[model samples]
Target: MKVKVVSLLLFMTGVMTFAQEDLKEREQQAAFDPAYTSYSRKKPAYVTLKDGTKIEGHIKDVDRKKGQIHRLKIIEDGKKKVEIQATDIADLYMAPSGLEQLDKQANFFNDATKWGKTDATKHLSKGYTMYTNQMVSLKNKKKPTEYLMQVVNPKYSQVIQVYSDPFAKQTASIGVGSLKLAGGIAKSYYVKKGEEIVWLTKSNLDEHFDRLFMDSEDFKSKYEGEKFKWSLLGVYILDYTEFALDAQMGEAK
Candidate 1:
């Protein structure tokens, strides 16, 4: 009789353990599960938190209780001198994007091109391609568009590669130099743990880029296409250790 009771208790314990694990799995799925596969259109939505912080990137998840942004993405501004990214600015109004969003943008541009409505917006090419000399010059001159390349996936973009990641272990980092709207050079450093830094190397991920924009907003009249200027633009000539983020990386050289 005692043996039967012991066996039943063990079985019940196993069932409870499985049930708890299932619940955790569900929670993670609802929260951090992969939402993007190749050709998977991710949506764009501005998540306004209680603190009035607005960002222009895609929302990964929202932590309303903790007042935080999860998995937010922003374009890297090529000009700024600080670690904070200017594209990280959250707008009071949020824009939406999904896999279908790409098709929509394409369709809209296609219709415009089909109709020759050049005044509407400049037509955009689909996916990454070698930039034309004119396009390259314009982007290099403008700066913002040049840095937009980092928005997708730096590793996949293959423009800038991570040669090292010493924080996690020995590390290597790939850096490609880009210009700010005002002609300041910025190098983007990719860390192995899927983190990207545009100007300065370290990031907490939750910090917004509004200040960077505000600091760099002086060249409105000077730069023609997309106007971006930096306020405090002191250069940082430090080794990779300055970016001290808490993620595993390959090696630094």
Candidate 2:
């Protein structure tokens, strides 16, 4: 009986040891696994501070809350790392590091800008910048379109639903809410023409395009002929603008 008891104790000890070894292996694998580590891995980027200082490093993490990038962790000098607040950062550019030549040329900028409302004094707080380009052109303007891009977290659109509960004394109630999952990241596009910045949408696409290309018969013919798809409206408008600009340039030469 004593010999059997000693054998059982030995077996339990061996089982515990094996379990611990397996757990340790899993922990080590997870540390190096791409799926688990990708979010924490640093990516090359250039950061510009509000005071005009520039820092080049690898981005360790970006903390986005309420649709704003509140903070960023950057790794520098191989071993040193620093956390920076959004207020101190002017912008950041994530360097493209893919095989495609076009991907290499792509620059993603995270910058702050005052957006929304027609009144210059009524603009909302700074928001995240998505795309910046001079896609729209005004007649006789020396410079390209100032800035045209999509912004996130500018403002929330309210939705209200009213319903009556027949079972509960036929009481009528109203529900008001907005997108909870947006986290304030719901986006809207804006364009700056002269001194005014206005929201862009599919409903107003024709009005804006007509105003910009009022004198271009070629543009009108081509634009009217193509069937615009809502999902591809942004792309179509950009392409049409480019075509118009090229035609104007050719005429000048």
Candidate 3:
């Protein structure tokens, strides 16, 4: 009886150890798999079509081979899955979650005018009007000014340094110049204000804001003291727009 009890305990221990090892192996494999990594970062988002149809789902994957998100896999209604090309989506909104709570909700629009153009412009609007990880606002309903903030600098770059040795021997070293690409390096603000496209920088921010909130003393008093940082420009714009919209809604009420 004692031997049988010990044998049973040993069998259970072996099974537990095997299960833990299997789990650890799976975790290590997942870490090395790009698909697995992308899947783990999937987030809830909503895609809107040009015809005013909205589809809510989890963005499973973003195909970004050409420096932009060209395709997206969305799991709709919690189970119904669909893959959408960028051309089909008018806009995409990604919800904030967990550590992303500090980040602004991502909103991208499709700029139709740039479609089928060549050079960097072709990459600009493959089918979608806007780039990922950006904020968009329609300031005027009657005139409809689309306010957009984008990063102009490369997200990543590599620096290579070569040295010549004069003391010992002469040698030649060949290095490959590989391009590193990333998004949201340098910030640029653009506004399509009533038939004109205006680029806003540090110099013009004050002028634009002044014109935008000409009658609102409250907006000026609250934001005038705040220093503008490039990294936080999007957040500031989003907050200011929300505040102005809220104030307008309140006045209407």
Each model's lDDT comes to: 0.25, 0.39, 0.39
Give one clash count per candidate, in the order shown. 33, 0, 5
Sorted on lDDT, best first, the list reads 3, 2, 1
Residue lDDT tens for model 1, 50-82: 445533333333221111111233332342222
**Clash count, predicted structure 3:** 5
Higher-TM-score candidate among 1 and 3?
3
TM-score of each predicted structure versus truth: 0.19, 0.38, 0.33
On the 0 to 100 scale, the lDDT of residue 197 in model 3 is: 39
22: Cα error in model 1, Å: 4.4
Q: Residue-wise lDDT of candidate 2 within 67-89, one digit each (tens)?
A: 23457788876668899876676
Better of 1 and 2 by lDDT: 2
Q: In model 2, where do residues sit more than 4 Å from their true spots?
A: 1-40, 50-52, 78-80, 85-90, 95-218, 225-227, 244-253
lDDT of candidate model 3 versus the reference? 0.39
Look at candidate 3 and give me any clashing residue pairs.
109-130, 110-128, 110-129, 111-129, 155-182
Candidate 3 lDDT by residue in tens digits, 1-253:
9999999999999999997776444322211100011222344565676677778777676675313355778888647779887667665654323311111111211222211233223322221122222222222123432211222211100011011111111113221112111221222334433334344444466666555443556656766776654333333433444455556667878
